[model samples]
Target: MRFFRAAYAVAWKDVLLELRRKETFTAMFFFSLLVLLMFNFTLNLDRTQVLSLAPGLLWLAITFTGVLGLGKGFLAERENECMDGLILSPVPRGAIFLG
Candidate 1:
């Protein structure tokens, strides 16, 4: 219960921060859009080929965006010393990992 509470708290904090800033969301949106545009121009694929490739391209964009967002979030936390505070908190290691 305690672990879950800590994880929830961390997650809520991150959600609130993200809602206020929106930097990650905006970057990911543009990056995914650019990737789709690039594929459209570079592939010159017919409709059938595009349909087949769409799933792969979508997953690629999602995976990369998640990586980029996580990296940026962690970097920002580190820069602000929030990561250190989390580390020093009494929360269990697993809870921190979940967070």
Candidate 2:
């Protein structure tokens, strides 16, 4: 219970910071949109084919965007020295990850 509480606290802090800046959300949105657009232009699929492929394409964009977003989030924390602060805290590594 304590472990979960700490994890929630950490996650909440991360969420609040993200809400304040909105960079991660915007970047992820644009990146995913760009990816989908690239595919749409390149594939030239008929409407039926595009409909069929929608799920796969969406997942592909989501996968790449998620990877980039995680890296960007880590970089933000590192640049602001927050990563070191988190490291010095008593929080378990898993809790930090959950954040």
Please state the error at residue 9 of candidate 1 in Å: 1.3
lDDT of 1 at 76: 79
- Residues 11-42 of candidate 1 have per-residue lDDT tens digits of 88888877887878899789888877887898
TM-scores, all models, native as reference: 0.89, 0.86
Q: Total clashes, candidate 1?
A: 0
User: Alpha-carbon error at 2 in model 1, in Å?
Assistant: 1.5
Model 1 RMSD to the real structure? 1.3
Q: Point to the candidate with the largest TM-score.
A: 1
Q: Report every candidate's CA lDDT.
A: 0.85, 0.89
Candidate 1 lDDT score at position 61: 76
Question: Considering summed lDDT, which 10 consecutive residues are worst modelled in model 1?
Answer: 15-24
Candidate 2: stretches off by over 4 Å: none
Worst 10 residues of 2 by lDDT: 14-23
